[model samples]
Every structure is written in structure tokens, then in C-alpha cells.
Target: MKSLSILITTVTFYLISSMYSYAQQTTDQIKDQQFTEAKETIIQDEREALKVEVEEINNRLQNGSISKTEADTLKNKAAEKHAKNIENRLIILKNTLELADRNGDQEKESKTGIYVGWDEDANDFVIKTSVKRKKEKKEVYDFRTKTGVYLTWGLLDLVDDDNSYGNTDVSVGRSTSFEVGISQTTRVFKKSNFLRIKYGLGFEWNKLTPRDNTYLVDNNGINTMEQFPSELRKSEVRFTNIVIPVYFELGPSKKIESQNYIRFSTQKQFKIGFGGYGGLNIETMQKLKYREDGRKVKQKIKRDYNTTDFVYGVGAYVGYGSFSLFAKYELSPLFENQPIDKNLLSLGFRLDFD
Candidate 1:
């Protein structure tokens, strides 16, 4: 407690002495003293800037962006640069001080590291900093991967096992395929964005409408297409699937880089992707509409119908910016066991928003 009281008494006397010293100064005398002390402040500021530069270079070295030798060289160059700045600025400040002492008056204007001077044109006293540190801007958009939702619709055509395209059973205009999902695209390389990997999860729909008055008949465990005894207005089979699609995309992007960050943009850029999708069939449903006993009747049935449970397909797309021409062909057989083995193919337009 006695030591604390002694410290308080000492501080009180120091404050009184400082106030007395401040009282003795005229405006011109105070300005001269302040101008002289600014030399030390400038030197200290340059040294501090040099330290910050060294720390930044060390960070690059630790991150493997620069080698140790390069970091050392950068550090040395920064030190030399600050040293030279200190020398040159001190010489100028010393010359100005000597001129002021010889003239026995404060200078109206003088070039120093930090300057407080009278501006004749502006008719005012101005302060200026000769040394300035560069500031880099942070990018507003900065990501290697982009995510968005996608929707697709297309015409579906069935192909027989022996035939590459076309089937006699399903109508081309009546059959349709659709997909909706979330998607992501990522850059494949550290320094290049020309190549990317795109992947997504989606729900798939495949619909087939039979031609003529024929309907699917399940006899025991065997299924076949047969004519219905009753007149039929519509007969169709719909398949729902959950799928994961992946693609290797090739494209060009606009790159903007600085000391702060690197950003890649695909705005108005053309891109092409080739990939495949695979997943399990969720469910299959059959719908029939016909006249029974002179009254309209509709029937719905849910069954596997020996259809393949595993759904897989190859897909390709070419586009500019947000829209693309897309095509996909199903590789798995339509049925696990059937008289005619068939596959499905679809072509349509797609939109991706990111």
C-alpha cells in the first residue's frame, strides 16, 4: 500500500511538470519542436511497415506458396527498402531543420516524411504522409465450387435389345422423361479452372404410353402385352427413380486475382459436360382409363412388373451460361425378364442456376 502511494505521488509530480512545459511553448516554438520529433516517428513507422512485410512473406512460405530462399530474399529486399527510405527522409528533415535554425524562424513549408505546412494556394495549413501502404480489396464472390438447383424435361424413346433405337410398343410423342435436382460444380485444379467436376442428386421420371387398345397383362409370373376386352381411352406405365449424376466438364472462366483473393466466373461462357447417372427405382405405377358397363372408369395399379430395380444412364450437355442442350440414354434393361428387352433414351434442354 505504501509503494502504491509513492507511485501515485510520482505520477502527480510528472503530470505537473509536463503541464508546466506545455505552458512555456509559443505556437511557433511548439510547431518547431513537433516537426523535429516527427523524424523519429517516421523512422519507427517505416520499421513497423518492414516488419509487416516480413510477416506476410513468412506466411506465404509457411503455406508453400513460396520457397524459403524466396522468402528470405523478399525479407532482405524489404529491409533494404525501408532502410533507404529512413536515410533519405532523415537527410531531408535534417536539412530543413538546419535551414530553420539558420533563419531563426519556422519554415512555412518543408518536405519531410510527415509534413505540416502552410499551403499558399489553399491558404491553409495541411498535413501529408509521404509513405503509404498499399491496400488490396477483398473479392465479393470467391469460391471454387458453386451449387444450384436444376430442372430438365425431354422426349423419351425406347430401344429394343437387338435395335439401337425405336420400339414398336411405345409411342414416341407420348413417352416422356423429366428430372429435378440440386447440383454442384468444382474446379479440378489449383491454378486452372478449365476443367471441373459436376455432381448432383435428383429425382427421375420415365413415362411410356402404349399404342392401340393393347394393355400389359400379368399371366402368372410372366408379363405380356395383350388387347383389352373393353375399349380403352388411355394406358400408360410410369417409373420413378432417385439418382446421383456426375460429370467431367470442360470450360473457360474469367479469373480475377489480387493479393487478397482469387475468383473464377463463368458468366456468358460456353461449357460442355459428359457424365452418367445411377440410382435405384423408387416405384412403378400403371394407369388405365376405359368405359365399363357404359360408364367411364379409371384403374390404377402399383407393381414391379419385372422392371429393372437399378436405374443407370449416360448423359451429355453443351451450353452457354445458364442453358444447355442435354441428352441421356438409359443403359439398364427395362425389364428383368421379358420377351422384348428394351432401353430408353431422352433428349431435351436443361437450365442450371448458380
Candidate 2:
């Protein structure tokens, strides 16, 4: 009876031990499954975070606002994170395969596939794709036009054989006079290689100073006339002319492709053109004399040298953005049948627009 009881007790103890071992194995398997799921979750989260970071960094780069160093740093950080995430996924995959092998479960082992980490090359590939897209979207323009106002000063030369009173005179001066005027220019045509026209009106002012001298006889000595000097005499002549100028321009069409403070953006902004002009010039002259009381007397010899006629010229203009410099030589004389011959030559600067 004692032997039988001992046998039964041993059998019960063996069954309990076997049952406990089976339960512990089952628990371990469950833990492994949970760990694998958790690892996969962590890897997926990491990949998603990496994708967000990459997008943010790419946006900053495209915006062109960040410094070069900052962009490079962000790129390196993203690359490192990508490598780490790949490594973690690869480790989890290897462990999963090893766990399946240890359990000798053919089905689970067959199901366990290797996790290839996020492709390192893919980040660079995406960046390159974005860069190519941006490059394809750049734009370019062909032609442009602008205009503005201008002021000029030039020397006027007179060439005639007439005096202040329209009389034949070796007594009058034939020196070049000074002139000044203002105008506006507008561009009419523009092309890659083409011609342009600019038209504007100007007003010119001129003055001529004569040279001739006469002497007066006195009891004590010869005295120079106060108004007309004994050695040198001079007459003052003034003229005002209204002029119109047309400029023919030629050059590259893409001169003003870029935006700038100057009206145009081309070195070839300088142009040479023929100009036709028509206007009225009012001319007057004055003579001076000395009185016995030591006072000077002034007389107007010619007040209405007013003439309406055509004035034309050939000129050249050079421009730097909105600023321009010009020179012109008149083809016709200021007056017809005058005592003196006069031709107009002028130099001046102007502001232009389009």
C-alpha cells in the first residue's frame, strides 16, 4: 500500500511539472510576439518621422531662405536618422527570423521576411527629383521699353556777314555762342536686333557778344568812349529757339531684361540717329554808350529778328539706365541772310523712360 501511494504521488508531481513547463513556454512565445509587434510599430513611427523631417528640410531648401550651412546640416542629420532607422528594422527582422528558427515553427519561419531598411539612395533621389522640377519651371522674357525727360547744353556757332542792324559789317563778332535746352524721349519699337525711334521737343537759348572799339578826342588826351570804347566795341545779341528732335535707335532687343533703377539695362544703350526739327527763334541786339555825366546809356538796335523756319540735325545719344548724354550738330543756320553765320551744336544729359 505504501509503494502504491508513492507511485501515485510521483506521477502527479511529474504531470504538474510538465504542465508548468508548457505554460512558461507559451508565455515566452506570447512575449516574443508582443515584442516583435512593438518593434515594428517603433520602426514604422521612426520612418514616418523621418519622412516629415525630410519634407520640412526640402521646403526650406526650395524657399532659398536658409543659409547653406544650415541646409547641409539638416541634410546630414536626415541621412543619419535614415541609416539608424534602417539598422533598427534590419535588426528586428533578423531577430524575428532567429526566433522562428528556435521555435522550429515552419509556418512562422516561412512568414518571417527580412526587413530592408529605408533606402539611403531614395532620399538623394527625391532631392534630385525636386531640384529637376524647379529647374524646369524657370522663366525668361524677350523685350522691354522705357521713356523719360532730358536736359542739354551746347555751343552755338554763328556764320554770317551781317551786323546788329542787318547791315554788312566787319564790325560784328563771329564766335560760337552757348546754348541750352530740355526734351523728352519715347521708345517706339524694340526687338532682339532691331531699330527704335524716340521723339521729343526742346527749347534752346543763345547769346552772341561782339568785338569792335572806337576812340573819342579830348583836349587833355584821347578818351575811350564809355559806351563804345576807343580800342574795342561790342554788341550783345540774344536768341531763343524752339526745337523738335527725333532719334533712331538700333541694338539688341534684350537690353532691359533685368529690373533696375535705370530705365534700360544695356551697354549698347548709346545710339546714333538723324533728327528733323522745326521751330521759331526770337533774336535781339543791344549797344552801349558813355554819357558826359559818367553815366552809361543802352540802346536796342534790333529787337525783332524773329524768324519761323525749319531746323534739322544729326545726333548721338548714350544712355546708362535712366540717365542719358547726347550731342547734336544742326544742319541749317539760325537766320537767313543775317550779318553773321550761325550753326547750332549742343551737348546735354537727360532722364529717359519706356
- Model 2 bad stretches (over 4 Å): 1-145, 160-184, 188-190, 212-234, 251-269, 283-293, 298-302, 306-310, 317-327, 338-354
Q: 68-133 in candidate 2: lDDT tens per residue? A: 689768856765665566554545445554454455432222243322222234321011111112
| TM-score of model 1 (CA atoms) | 0.59
Ten-residue segment with the worst summed lDDT in candidate 2?
123-132
Predicted structure with the largest lDDT when compared to the true one: 1
Query: Per-residue error at 188 for model 1, in Å?
Result: 0.4
Q: After superposition, how far is residue 82 of candidate 1 from its true place, in Å?
A: 58
Off by over 4 Å in 1: 1-141, 256-259
